[model samples]
Target: MNNQHETPEQKRERLRQEELKKNPIGTLKDGFNGNGNLADLVGSLGWKGTGILIVVLIVGYVFYKLFF
Candidate 1:
């Protein structure tokens, strides 16, 4: 039996395997699934929600300026 250390090619193959194990692409695909739902929720809100958000922001700014 040969108890030799790994060659350079073997080391590179091992490194590649380790990298794939650590960061699989499937996990990335799973991570972004919520973004689609968030987009759909925002789209359903329409302009009325946007207008309310703007008004709230303006009121918040006014309050901040008055208080500080």
Candidate 2:
């Protein structure tokens, strides 16, 4: 609870846990490791997957434009 009282190992573990919480979808971690580009990431999922992703994005964009 108290950073000043935490040993170095405890602090490191706490920070790691916090990092995982911040990136539950692993997107941030993937980006940090250099696969940040959305197209590249989606391409890795194959044609069907890419198609699904594109459709989802387009639908989302349309909804956003219409609503906002």
Candidate 3:
């Protein structure tokens, strides 16, 4: 595809992919530092939804432990 035909979002994503390949360790660091959508979703969920998610995770872990 030609750069001239690329949309703005497509250009940004292509650049991001190139940068990711050049600095994967930086990507991992950013992910661990919660510079991603998971953190945003958790924050947007508010305390009640966050608590419910934690409870569900705990239950899933217990089930995994029991079965595996």
Candidate 4:
């Protein structure tokens, strides 16, 4: 085992290289291409629906407090 200490910049650059390798396109789009229907794409992801549900619940609670 080896204990190597790297500077902050060095560590950042190393992580950047790893991410570039994972995403060669070098963009934050998550590899989704254009021309695809936005609703279909979002609906395909289960977590997105759950997140929207949570937001709706929070807003409903806030509105309830404001009105009642």
Superior candidate under TM-score, 2 versus 3: 3
Candidate 3 TM-score over all chains jointly:
0.53
Which residue pairs in candidate 3 have backbone atoms (N, alpha carbon, C) closer than 3 angstroms, thus clashing? none
Query: lDDT of all predictions, in order shown?
Result: 0.57, 0.68, 0.73, 0.58
After best superposition, candidate 1 residue 35: deviation in angstroms?
4.7
Task: At residue 37, give the lDDT of candidate 1.
Answer: 44
lDDT of 2 by residue, 1-68 (tens): 88999999999878755755666357544744785665335534547866887899999999999999
lDDT of 2 at 62: 100
Which residue segments of model 3 deviate by more than 4 Å?
Answer: 38-60, 63-68
lDDT per residue for candidate 1 within 1-68, as digits (tens), equals 13267888888766655644666453334334553343333333446865786799899999999999
CA error at residue 32 for candidate 4, angstroms: 31
TM-scores for every candidate against the unseen true structure: 0.38, 0.43, 0.53, 0.34
Off by over 4 Å in 1: 1-42
Where's the lowest-lDDT run of ten residues in candidate 2? 37-46
Q: Write the per-residue lDDT of candidate 4 for residues 32-55, one digit (tens) a residue.
A: 465434433343334666488679
Clashes of each: 0, 0, 0, 0
For residue 9, give model 3's deviation from the true position in Å.
1.0
Error of 3 at 1 (Å): 2.0
